[model samples]
Target: MIEEPGRVVAIEREAVWIEALDEAACPGCTASVGCGRWSFDWLETPRRRRRIRALSVMPLRVGDAVVVGIREDFLLRSTLAIYLLPLLGLFVCTIAIQQLGFGESLMIPAGFLGFVSVWAMVRRISRRQMNDPTLQPVVLRALPGASEGQVRQAAF
Candidate 1:
C-alpha cells in the first residue's frame, strides 16, 4: 500500500476531494552540498497538485486533513492496461498483415487500426472494473491538528 497526507478540499456524501503536493523524489546527486542544483530544480520544476476523490471512513469537512491509501497493484494494472496492449496490437497486426504479402500502405493502416482497437478494448475492460474494491482509494484516518498549539503539543 502507498499512502499520502492531503488536505480535504471538499466533501460530497462519502467522497472527499484531496489535493496532495507532488514532491520531487530526489533533489540532488552525490556531488552537491551547496551547488547550482537548488536554483535549477526550482525554475525547471513547477508546483504540482494532484487531486483525487477518496471514499472516507469517517465524516469529513472542507479544510480537514487526512491520510489516503491505495494498493500498489492498482498502479501496475492501470499502466499495463493503458500501454502494453496497444503496443502488442501494433506488432501482431502489422506482422500478420505483412505475412500475407500486403504492401506497406496496407500494413501501416492496419497497424494503426489495431492500436486503436486494442486501446478501446482496454478502456472497456477497465471501465467494467470501475467498482472493483482494489482500485478505489480510501481515507484511512483524520490528521490530528490544523493549528499551531495542537500540532506542537502532539509533536512532544
Candidate 2:
C-alpha cells in the first residue's frame, strides 16, 4: 500500500473530501540527493491544491489530518490498461489492415478508430473498478493534536 498525508476538507456521511499535502522532495528517484531537480522540486508543484473523495472508515471531521492509502498494484494495473492497451491496439489495427491490401488513408483511420475503441473500453472498465476496495483510497489514520485551524503538514 502507498500512503500519503492529507487533511479532511469536508465530510458527508461515510465519504470524506481529502486534500493531499504536496511533497517537495523527489519521489523515489535514484539520485534524490544529488539531482538538482530534487533539490528544487518545489518549482514544479502547482499553485492550487488537489483533492479526492475517499472512504472514511473511521470517525472523521472537517479539518482533521489523516493518512490515506491506496494499493500499488491497483494503480499499476489501471495505468497499463489506460495507456499501453490502446497504443497496442493502434499499431495492430494499422499493420493488419495494410497487409489486407487497404489504402494508407483507410489504414490510418482504422488505426485511430481502434485506439479510440480501446480507450472507451478502458473508461468503462475503470468505472466498474472504482467500486473495488483494493483500488479505493481509505483513510488509514487520523493525526492526533492537529486541529481544524492548523495548516496541513507536507508528507514526503
Candidate 3:
C-alpha cells in the first residue's frame, strides 16, 4: 500500500474527506544545472490543496489525523489509462484511415476524433470505477494520539 498522512476535514456517513498534509518536494539531482525546473522556480505556482474523499474504515472526527492508502497496482493502471490510451487511439485511428485509402488530409481529423472518443471512453470507465471500493483510497489507520474510544469502536 502507498500511504500518506492526512487530516480529516469532514465526515460524511461512510466517507471522510482528507486534506493532504505533505507537499511534494523536488528530487535532489546533481544535474540541476541543466534542468529547466531548477530555473523555473520563480515562475512556479503553489500547489492547490488536495482533498480526497476516502472510504472510512473506522469512526472518525473532522480533526482526526490518519493515514490514507491506495494499492500500488491501482496507481500504475490509472497512470497508463490516463496517458497512454489516448495516444494509442490516435495512432490506431490514423493507421486505419490510411489503410482505408482516405486522403492524407483526412488523417489528422480522423485521429483527433479517435482521441476524443477514447478520452470519453476513459472518462466513462473511471465513472464506473468510482463505485469500485478496491480502486478508491482507504483510511488505513488513525495516527497515534487518537481518543481511546475511537480505537475501541474500530476494534469491534
- The global Cα lDDT (0 to 1) of model 2 is 0.78
Q: Per-residue lDDT tens digits of candidate 2, residues 1-156?
A: 777777888887777999875553345567767887666665666434679888877888787888787888887887899899999989999999999999998999999988999999999988987777657788878886675334334333
lDDT against the true structure, per candidate, is 0.76, 0.78, 0.79
Number of the candidate with higher TM-score, 1 or 3: 3
- Model 1 scores what on Cα lDDT? 0.76
Model 1's number of clashes is 0
Worst ten in a row by lDDT for model 2: 147-156
Ranking by TM-score: 2, 3, 1
At residue 98, give the lDDT of candidate 1: 100
By lDDT: ranked, best first: 3, 2, 1
Report the Cα RMSD per candidate.
5.3, 4.0, 6.4
TM-score of 2: 0.79
* lDDT (Cα, 0-100) at 41 in candidate 2: 62
Q: Which pairs clash in the backbone of model 2? A: none
